[model samples]
Target: MDTGVAIFPTHDAIAPADVARLAEQRGHESLFFPEHTHIPASRATPWPGGRPLPRRYAHTFDLFVAVTAAVTATTRLRVGSGVCLVIQRDPIITAKEVASVDVLSGGRFEFGVGAGWNREEMANHGTDPRVRMAIMRERVEAMKAIWTSEEASYAGSHVSFDRIWSWPKPAQRPHPPVLVGGDGPGVLDRVLAFGDAWIPNHAPAGILERAKELRARADRAVGLIVMGVPADPRVLEAYAAAGFARAVHWLPSAQRGPVERAFDAFEAAVAEFTGE
Candidate 1:
């Protein structure tokens, strides 16, 4: 199993380039950052974690910008958004950004996307929470078309556009791996439908088994990428045995000391568990 780190690149945290350089120096395989274009103050949608939304969400840096910084700072470490909110973005623009970053990063970009949780926040972007999944699906499809075609266009229920040419296609042939993030049934189906991987938070027991069964039926080698993983060797081993391809440790905050400690612990645990 490969190890990665997930961070919220906020203004208060360590710079993205520095974090990426540190992760590469520590021999971590990848660095993932979460995204929030902007946070809504309405608080109409309760925090998923059952407390006030954290300040990091409101001050997070743009995902593509952060990834670009990471790519510029490191040679081998893969860079990605832990979960880009595709439901709120324009697919054409997003496709161009993804391709640009992938090319710049030498194909070391993982496109992890999600239909976000905040209803009022989605509304702020002119996205309907009711049809978020549908919109997200259409957006992803549109982006894929753009990445793979010389003159691409999409005309879906939620996304429609004329044929237009885009340049500097993704460095990775076809496109970067599209990893869908969520835990619901619909989200799993979306993963099977378009995503190359399923990125879920640490799931309940038997979830991995169920996911394997679903993957078998779909005849897809769709990988399982777990986020917010505990810093335990046993847990890492268990997840690997359960078929997770990647496990990413989430930092409590972006402070340098805390982040360094988390990476140190992760490196030791990985060495102990995998003899790498």
Candidate 2:
């Protein structure tokens, strides 16, 4: 089981470069950053967590930019978007950005995508809330074509394009891993369709068994990436037993001090678990 770190790259958090370097030095497998292009002022969409959305959601850094910085600063630590909102962006532009990052990072990018929960925010991007999942699926398929082909093109219900040229195809063969994020029933179907992994955030207890059954039913070899986990050895063992390929723990804050302390604690915990 690989251990990784995920952070909300906010104005007050640790710089991406520093975190990347530290995580790499500490033997962490990956550094993931979450994305929120822009939070709408309208409070029509209730927070999925059942509370007011945090201010950090509005002040978050662009995930591609943050991940690019981290990749440049570290050689081995994988860089990922913990969960990028695929429904809100133009698939063509996103495809280019993803391919560029993969090339620049020496193929160390993981594309974790999701149909986000912000209805108003999706509305701002002209995306229909009712069809967000369908749109997201089409966008991901379109991006995959762009990443793998020199004269790539796509035609789908939500995405259609003529042959267009894009450079710097991903360093990783067939492009970086596409990890779908969600716990919905349809989400598993989508993952089996195209994603290389499934990442569910703070899943319910007994989720592992359920996910295993789902994978078995689909006959997919994709991994299960569990995010937002606490830094506890016992929890790690449980996740491992549950067949998690990777587990990501959150940094308490993005500030240097808190991030450093979190990394220290994580390293110790990982070491204790691995007997290193």
Candidate 3:
């Protein structure tokens, strides 16, 4: 299995270009950054970890900008949004961003997407939390049309546009790989429907069983990328044995020296686990 890294690039953290170069030099396969447009200061939604939200969530750099910096700094390291909240973005604009990165990066981009959990946050974007799944699906479908067709159009309850021309068609023929994020019930269904990969947080239990089940399907093929993985050799071995294609180690937002030290540690763990 291949190893990658994920970070929430913040104003105070190591610059993304440096992170990308270091990750490439250390022999990592990919770099992923996640998005949070803005976190509401007060919300009824409790953080899943039962603690205050991390500072990084409130301070993250824009996903596209971070990914662009990383990809431009390194030629071979794949860059992605660990989970771009599709329900909260304008699909047409996002389609252009994805294609631009893919084209400029020589086809090395992965599109990881999710229906986010913050109700008030989504409300701020004019997205209803209750229908986020449907909206996310429609948006992704619409974006796919925009990417693959010369004069593409989509008509959906949430997103619709007339025939439109979009340029810089992605270097990857059918656009960058869409890795659907989340292991909630029916998430695999979404992956099979329109996504090129299945990405789930490596925690919250039962994911191992789900991964095994997904891998058992012989008729369909999908990439599997597990996010927020622990840098444990045993866990890495288990993931590879369970048929995971990639595992992303979490990189906490921090100043350059500390963060680079953490990368070195993770790199050593990866090398040991992969016998490289």
- Winner on lDDT (2 vs 3): 3
Per-candidate RMSD, Å: 1.3, 1.4, 1.3
Per-residue alpha-carbon lDDT of candidate 2 for residues 1-276, written as tens digits (9 for 90 to 100): 998998888877778888889888888899899988898887888887887777888888789889989999999999999899999999889988998999898899999999888898899899999999889989999988988887988989889999999877888989899999988768878888878998988655756876777678676588888998776777788788878989898886557887888888877777777778
Each model's lDDT comes to: 0.88, 0.86, 0.89
Question: Cα lDDT for residue 252, model 3?
Answer: 74
lDDT of 1: 0.88
For model 2, what is the alpha-carbon lDDT of residue 61?
Answer: 79
TM-score, one value per model: 0.96, 0.95, 0.97
Per-residue lDDT tens digits for candidate 1, residues 1-276, read 888998999888899999999889987898999988888877788878899788888998899999999999999999998899999898888998999999898999999999888898899999989999999999999998888898988999999999999887999988999999988767778888899988888855756776677578677588888988887888899889888889999875567898898888877888888866
lDDT top scorer: 3
Query: Candidate 1: TM-score?
Result: 0.96
lDDT of 3: 0.89
State the TM-score for model 2. 0.95
Better of 1 and 2 by lDDT: 1
